[model samples]
Target: MEDWYYKVDEKFLICSICGYHYDKYAEYDEENNTPFRVEISGGYGSVHLETKKGDWIRIYLDGNLSAGELKAYKNVFENCNKEKSYLMTYEGNGFFTIHFGNPPEHFLISFKEYLENLPEDRQNDVF
Candidate 1:
């Protein structure tokens, strides 16, 4: 049997059920001194998502994504009309859908207020 494990931000997290190490991070902008790096390895039969908490969410592989498709997806994530935080959902095939679950607008104001108290560089790191 194949072993499965998850690694988040350099720490290896063992899946209790599979007893395998899955080391994956969702790191972006290596020059930014971030603590993680997003890596995708499985192909054809499986796709894995390793969150910052070292949790592995596995999904069956169904299709491939071209460079353009990937860029479009990232664009959607980075340039969405969202009032707060949001998540992405794959709508079968190779398309993706964005879902917004932002809290109340007032809460967002307060959250932003709190974030503003942090250093300028720290604010840029919110993803």
Candidate 2:
């Protein structure tokens, strides 16, 4: 097997609930030239992997994350095998990103709770 590490050639999203797999970077619409992405449909936490090697994170928060959601994100960012996770929030319509030096190609989208909540239960589990 080839040691394809830190290569953006391949990307995937794995579900932590039903153990489902999805294509992360395969968001391309031929007709409209738009990419449709499906994150963790139903799961406690999800994982996004990129063969490309880079420590960069960009997450858009639309007030969709459920309770303890932010904590989950921090959890993943904190234990990123780095000295410290740098986090910054902007004032642009909830647009935020994280820059990690030598970050792992695999991104574990941590969600505190997916279910067990009534109102936010139906919300899509994605940052």
Candidate 3:
């Protein structure tokens, strides 16, 4: 229902849930005083997100994403309905690995349309 961001050092994120970093994202929980889970781990260039509740999520770019792609993905995060789907930037570039469990196939179709509706600048980065 709310989104927040924070700058985090590399050591803060851990993959307790997945047991590994996916290179594009990672997450940590400070309430427990340790990492509760991490996403998109084991990559070079990473994007970190921290919530007001002291929870952290990060995506490691690993040089797979270009400037333009990253820009477009930022747009997606700003525009898409976060409640309806999950997005991951594990491989970087604008190409997101999305998971939509609600009405699964329908959500995928909607996501595809979301991409199609993007301006050319954003569309090109999806690989």
Candidate 4:
């Protein structure tokens, strides 16, 4: 397992090896909407999200992501559209589908720079 640490000032959970930073709180309130538990091990882990219905949903991250992808995730969380509801969905393999507005405007984003550096066979393989 890689040694990881959190940066309080920036609210980032960073990977020591590649220095990739994952937004700790991202735009969610720590007191309420934040992930209750985040377990990162061997470069990948799960985030436990509390739903509006009071159910806990465990979302897994494969840990293969580029800086752009992380930034996009943060941007989605930090920005508020005029729409009353916004949903961000992790579509596995570092892709995210963001929906905004009542009728919903969809956006798909993923950064392949990091993954492209890996061997061709390992590029799409998840941890």
Worst 10 residues of 1 by lDDT: 11-20
User: Candidate 4 residues 1-127, lDDT tens each?
Assistant: 1222444333435432222345433344655656433433333432333434454433345554466865664464344333333334343456444433232221221234555556789755533
Most lDDT-accurate candidate:
3
Better of 1 and 4 by TM-score: 4
**In model 4, which range of ten residues has the least summed lDDT?**
101-110
Q: What TM-score against the true fold does each predicted structure earn?
A: 0.20, 0.23, 0.22, 0.21
Q: How many backbone clashes does candidate 1 have?
A: 13
The TM-score ranking, best first, is 2, 3, 4, 1
Between 1 and 2, whose lDDT is larger? 1
Off by over 4 Å in 3: 1-43, 73-127
Scored by TM-score, the top model is 2
The positional error of residue 56 in candidate 3, measured at the CA in angstroms, is 1.8
lDDT string, candidate 1, 23-69, tens digits:
54555557757766534332222223344445544443334545675
Residue lDDT tens for model 3, 1-127: 1122334433333332112343312356565556444344344334444444455454544445566876666665454444432334335353335422122243234446866777989775543
RMSD of each predicted structure: 15.6, 17.7, 17.1, 16.6
lDDT of each: 0.42, 0.39, 0.43, 0.40
Minimum summed lDDT over a 10-residue window in model 3 is located at 16-25
**Clash number for model 4?**
0
TM-score, candidate number 2: 0.23
